[model samples]
Target: MIQNKGEMTVEEVRLNEGHAFLKGKLQADLLYVGEEDGRIYSLSANLPMEETLNLDGIVNGDKMCLKWEIEDLSIHIIHSRKMNIKAVVTFFASVDELTGVRLPVSLDDETVSVQKKTMRVLSLVIHKKDTMRLKEEITLVSNKPNIAELLWYTTEVRGLDLRPEENSVKAKGELFIFALYTGDDESGTLQWIEHSIPFNGEVECSGCISEMIPNLEAAVINQTLEVKPDADGEERKLQADVVLELDMKLYQEEDHEVIMDVYTPFRQCMPKGRKEILESLLVRNFSRCRIADRIEVKETQGKILQICHSQGKIKIDKIQIVKDGILAEGIVRLKVLYIVENDEMPFYSMEAMLPFSHVVEAKGITENSVYYLHTELEQLSTTMVDSNDIEIRATIGLNVLVIQCSEEMILEKIEEIPLDQEKIRNMPGITVYIMKPGDTLWNIAKKFYTTVDEIIQMNNLDGDEVSSGTPLLLVKKVEE
Candidate 1:
């Protein structure tokens, strides 16, 4: 087989006159002279041999695209006859990676789809060869040298920076890329919790379970052993309230693709940019082409995105803001503390629906402007025990910073460890008072400033059965 050295005159370069893209430097077929030796040549480019063109491991049939040359190749070849191409796209089937050229195709078609593949072994003289033997480098490369010539299925949009609030600041930005996935119902769930229980003197508690058991051994002997003999708990929280502080989160769905005419407006009236991008669909001949449709000069769509990102800020009394870092959109996710006064300490115990914190577009707000007003409150609750000692606690969704406070401050919720025996004994119903004549549970409750229910609870009474001479224990107050 006769091998051809690829070469052609520069006359074939096609010029799309009036093309908006023609404004820049061009590399078209104008330089490929249909020159040929007595034998068939592989391929050649407009570049001189001394130029030493570097092919990025391009294999035959591999898709190639245009990128700005870091240095001017024409300047480097100063003295040589300068050749320029219109920078028109080309398709190749056979390639010479070493020479950076595409071989002629046997078939005839203005637009061709490659069918078969072939490779070759060629040699270049570095300096010398001994005994008529040549050292050859065998590399397989693609004939197609233009990205617009190959078949690509995947498309990417990148470098989309999103600034919800302002510019010149370290605002949040994200690349909302498009995707055409093969399936749906792809989802995941995330969760976390900090649990606590209130405590008072010697209470029983089971150790943390190592594993979940479905059924315990159904035997009397096992039941006794499971009782945990000598488990002797050192009075933990026997009487307590369980609280869980939860943070709810929400995220929008990703991986969706919409189809519309390439000329359709994106982000509403915000320019699908020049409407000329519709022409590039012709160049999309291949997918991986990073070429921005000649119209949207940006690598990807850059516009005002509609983000219903609903992570809202909480409105609280006195707030201490602790910031960590910027969110995906460049907004600051803040940590705020709500201050509670001793007079309002009891209010902290009742949990209210937490706030919805999110990013919002700020208008006319300056560096000195107050961004938002926090309305979240530090929740709390308290009850006077039978003995008049107060037990203050943080209700659900709130944290307890401390047990007793004479002044106002920020507080967090912690497990109420068991109180001292003295404190427990001092609580309202810890001790019982004996009943006297004319003291019905309700009557005695009123006289002693206690509750009828407290009296029944004190004596473990199931009903209103109270004999005049009967003795009963006093529990707590039944207020008017």
Candidate 2:
């Protein structure tokens, strides 16, 4: 009788072969310009002006955050005898290469197999052309401030959008610029002035494929900014030049046959079996979640006033994978700039560090599974209610990817009992035996304790053929 050993677990081996790279460019123009007096202050400054100019650039430094390559970046100020202010920006980009599995695998009732691989898909950048470019002209009429110095200026990317087209990728997003300067107010007292502007635009990526989608975990790799005063402008007018580089990675999920466990139940005596097993890494889940929360300002921070701007940063501290879900622990750091009810300074900056813990739904999570968690701030908004408190709203995005290492095994062979010799020797010698239909020499020899060669020689009569009811001579092997 054939016995079935229930099932055994085992793993298959696979290797990462190579990668494929996608290259493209991102180009746009700045929309915001400052004008003072009869002179026009544009991005390209030509005239001689006495002022201190400051510039800053912001980018992501995490190596494992995403895979991308920046080939070149350039920012130039465009000057026209008629136009007020204009800037040209360009970015050369290349994404990390992705490779799919190419090896062959086999599956059957006795064996189970699975394949692990990585795939890279392009993420197109998208943004509103009008909303991205923010331009405004402000004059401190009360202060009647003279253009003495440009203190500091910085640029950052808040969000990005990508979409696939027929043969190219569509990119859109906004760049946020903040500038701080020292100036004199109406009373001739020295004060700090803050100004913010946003530039938006959309471009079609020529070398990108249309089937790719925005990655759940895309990130900005590097960025550069240029700020200069227009020489011809009489008043303190400033122009900004900006450039940005982005990186995106693609991921794919596949299902494979894996052995859970194994057992066998037919043999009277326990059969000895051998097992074969392997270890492999597998991705269980890849998804993103948005987290929204509020923060309140304390009374000690002074009375309610106007809020200038708010920024949020998220850092992950720990991650735990449990049954059917995953738990994440992190802290949200918030920085706010606002005016106090009776403060001597025009604006006060306050920073708040908040601890947060959240759970994401993921099925089939076990203790043996490993995980990677990445978080980013998507949006931040604040409202002032009274002199003592302000309400803040923040939107955070979380990316979770799970991996599992599994083992599989299969029964190579089984052990069985030996044949009984005494019963075979007890058969009568020279006895007349009736031939049976559907009989073979080997089966007959096994039944009579004789070898197939002995049975063939003894029953010769022609070949090893016997008809039903035919008489045959049977002999039990005598010892020696």
Candidate 3:
């Protein structure tokens, strides 16, 4: 509310419309693959209302007009269940020359927002057909009666086998996901989580892992991630260039290492009271769903909105994610940065953290989303350490409002789209009139710069046509 554009002040700006990890392996098998933790059960942007945009009762200083209404509204999601497939600090690896090393996986989610002083965010969506399952929907319309919240996350990885091994065979990988966040009163419910880590690192040095060999030439194991937002736990620790690539067809070359399990989520911000048209209680039939590409109410809480919904997904390597089942269909992308109306205690909520991984034999086009990997060998050699410990959490909700913005200035000294002929001789009816012969518009608007119903709406004459002498084209602001 601090936009002092040289105020002569007379403003009434009419307007309104707005909206994983893994590690482990055989120092024994030369490092097999181990080390990972988990947490990801997404699609719960927050929902709960009933306060009605401030009205303890004020009786003064221009109330003009403002209104709102909403009852029994709900929407919320946050769930997971995949204890620990198998990992003792070796779920992602890369170490094979003697023969072994191609494991590294771990992916987590991020995207957040919160404002207060004005708010009218009416949308936030992330639906998937992988991980285990998925769904999340949010919509709003308010003037009064408020409570807003939306926060999302994404992280993933897959089986990393790399093929062709003998003296050491230990490449085991596992990750899963499931979500359904669309609740205005419980309807779309399903949030499950699971994480199993086992990817021992090895790939001493051979040469030939990228030669067009599907005859068997594939091994791309990459895992790189860095997300920050730590209120008290000192967040931000992941440096030295992120890299996770696994593509093979048949090669004697070897230098592979994979280990993943770094799912982090902790988004929080809550405040509510205003409504007019709110929805999200889960009842999705999106006719199959397809329109993604509009996310930006301030990043809408993200992992790039889970890679804009979902697709093939190739990267510099983030951690823990494998979606073949959890839900299906992927590809969600959007961008609209900001449009705040005012600002200061109108609505704000923020929370984020979702670790992901999926794969249970559920491939391509059930609608869409199909990405790739695997590691496994349980002889407990890197030092035998495991006991079902999969943990990664999230809680994202942010609402902040204070909006009323409109700018269209060009008055400096006045009139510049052509027109200043000496201010029309100080305006207010310019003199010089002599063209009788049946003049019109009531005799040329009495001869000069204005009136006569503004010269019949500035010469669009129909009831002011003066025949015999035509010379009319006056201007000084005339538009009904």
Candidate 4:
């Protein structure tokens, strides 16, 4: 095979005790030159895959968030028409469980005191993994040659902008289609065409609103290009089918009061707490990296006569949190198709692996930070440096999301018991208390076996706040 590309699609996920089962399929497109005709050709195949992952703290009802990519691929040709293909696929997964933290909404006993505080939380509203398909048919103009046989094709989706509305989302983007085919002329020469197809679509999403914060990830997963006949009975029409896989997460800001601490004149209450990490959106950055390199044509590979089409794939190797930014190190695998100075084989393809390193600005990022990074080939071009060398220029777009994580103690429930009779009885009915540095109205009231409202009314205070060393009057409630 001359070159290849691949994508992984996850179909099902089943969670059990501390493990997850995944079923998926891998699609690989292989490009090769014909043994007898010396002409280029393309073939596609799907391989079913199953994997078992050891996921800690996973349960049956927990939601599994999974994503996968083809990390590496290798093909070995056993014969002219037979080959062995092996792919290393990488999967990233996380588990999300919905649980309720129950704080006492209202205590039936009036003597049970509660200290409540309103917390602003960034809650996950919706997590959706969906797909959208785009289809287009185009006819070649008079200037372009009619297709005799389709050899190879590549497609990219770019500038996809999404807008959320009431229960739906609108997406607009352009699909870049590149194809190399043999012409139907007398000489049967090879020809290439590049076209941009604009597309707009809407997806129905339940509980989606414009005000919600959206984090979207999209990729061109599957595609097909077919040659067909035009109205004039010429093979000049091209049909393109593309599938875009989208992963969307929407968040909303909400405020709610949860009991932080509690006490009472009649009982003692203890709050059961669990530690959890709260993720807040820090920054969403779309940046570009420009790559320029020269590739020297070896003597074995024929000299380039004219450049036709160029395409690229980005593979990120590592990501590190550096000072004031994130450092991404990766390689851009570029394929360039050109007409060679040869009579038998007029067209040839060359491949190159160009290494690149870029830093995306993400201030305050650390080792504990969570992030999502995606890269796409925005543009690529080739210029002849000399008879034996070619210059490659490319622009790679980087989409990144840095999430700020914070640990919080969530109160789940409260346990109550009878209060110490000795402690309650020894307290005076009324006393003048001095507010300390860390004192609050609720804290003092709980200490003196009273309520925040009663303390404020008795002290004639404007609000619940008091300065250190300020004297406050406290009164204990007596039984009726």
Model 1 score (lDDT): 0.22
lDDT tens per residue, model 2, 1-480: 000001111122111223212232333222222333222122322322121112122123211221322222233335533433222222222222223322223324232111222322112233111112333443443444655544434444555554445533345545555544445344433333444444444434444445433343334433333333345454455554443333333232344443222221111122233343222323434344444445565566566578766666676678887667788888776667666674343445666766777777667767876555656665667777666666766666565655554433333333445434455446675577677778765556545545455666777767666677877666665442
lDDT by residue (368-473, candidate 1, tens digit) is: 2222121122232233332212233321112111111111111111122332445334556534455566555544544344555556666777876776566666
- Cα-based TM-score, every candidate: 0.12, 0.45, 0.16, 0.83
- Model 3, span 80-126: residue lDDT tens: 32121211221121212121212222212222111112222222121
Residues 74-159, candidate 4: write the lDDT tens digits: 88899986889999998888866765444334556666676776766667788887888999997887887789888778888876
The lDDT per prediction is 0.22, 0.44, 0.24, 0.81
Ranking 2 against 3 by TM-score, winner: 2
Off by over 4 Å in 1: 1-240, 243-249, 253-257, 262-480
Quick one: best TM-score, which candidate? 4
Residue-level error in angstroms, candidate 4, position 397: 3.6
Candidate 4 yields a Cα-based lDDT of: 0.81
Candidate order by decreasing TM-score? 4, 2, 3, 1
Please report how far candidate 3 places residue 288 from its true position, in Å.
20
Residue 349, model 2: Cα distance from true site in angstroms: 1.3
Give the lowest summed-lDDT range of ten residues in model 1: 277-286
RMSD to the true structure for each prediction, in A, is 41.4, 19.2, 33.2, 3.9
